[model samples]
Target: MKLVLACTAVVLLLSAVELARPMRRRKNSIAQIYRAANITPVPEQILQVNFGGIKVTPGLEVAPEDAVDLPTIGFDFIPGCYYTFLAYNSNYSISFLSPSIVGLYVNLNGDMLADSSAIATWLGPSPSPGTGINRYILNVYKQSGLIDTTDEQLLSYQIDRLRFPIDDFVATYGLSGPVAGTFFLSQYPVFASEDCL
Candidate 1:
């Protein structure tokens, strides 16, 4: 009888250990992708980015113009904590940062674009042909205070929206916790007929 009880306890312990393995592996896998992309060292809190009928997910392939409109960025809001939202193409030109939107709330009344001013006017994604899949990442950063920077400061290379100093910008403004992030892959159709374009 004692042997039977001991065997049962060992079986339960082994099962519990096995169950934990998958969770740990999944967390590590997610973080590794972020690190591999040089986007961040840790896994970001997931957020929803919906473009019309399509929803953005990590590494999901999407058509170019299908992602033309601004996605609806949704995430849980911390009370009184200001936020900064930005999106960039990590694959193209290193980092093609769109305008940064600052000082937003869960309820921005009606128009999110109107409620929040984009330091640089918002530009939609337009990956040039043959660029392959461009990873478009959108991150919502929790700001400690209102960001004190302008469009020029954010995009120093005014000639084109490339080589954005995202790391420097984050450090300079003391921005932390990209609280939430979501990304999708896009590329222009290289072989499509003229009508398709």
Candidate 2:
């Protein structure tokens, strides 16, 4: 009886450990961004977009298991959603690293949507050696006209004032390169209301 009880206890302990392991290893940024934007991040895969006649790739590559931080910059417009925040990149070129504005609309299923311009932020510089990170301040505008309640129009918007942090921009994105470095943007959805303002 003693031997049987000891074995049972060990089995139970191991089961408990197994259950807790996945939760412990879960990514942080995905949860954080989801909670803030009230949306979900797209599954890992290669996403391509065209910007300024250049092809761009954006997705979560660095720290694949970690959650990147995205705080609400501000809100504006009625019956619409406005998201403003800064994206930091320390592994790319200065010309490539800058503020990017992404505008998304909520579909009937409440999924955040993106268009071609979504990845337009990637048309610039390449990464250099020992680059730190570039910080960008962005303002995204969403209006009722752009919002399609029937999912017909498809949410659309533009990115403007794309610039790097003056002080540490150079060191962060490795802007000193003659060749452009490849960087990716997180595919996490940006949540917004489907109703137009």
lDDT (tens digit, per residue) of candidate 1 on 64-130: 7677666677777676566766677766733344322311222122225445545544465667666
lDDT of 2: 0.31
User: Using Cα atoms with residue i matched to residue i, what is each candidate's TM-score against the true structure?
Assistant: 0.67, 0.29
RMSD, every candidate, angstroms: 5.7, 17.2
Looking at model 2, residue 143 earns an lDDT score of: 23
Residue 116 in model 2: shift from native, Å?
15
lDDT of 2 by residue, 119-160 (tens): 223223222333433322122322222222333222211243
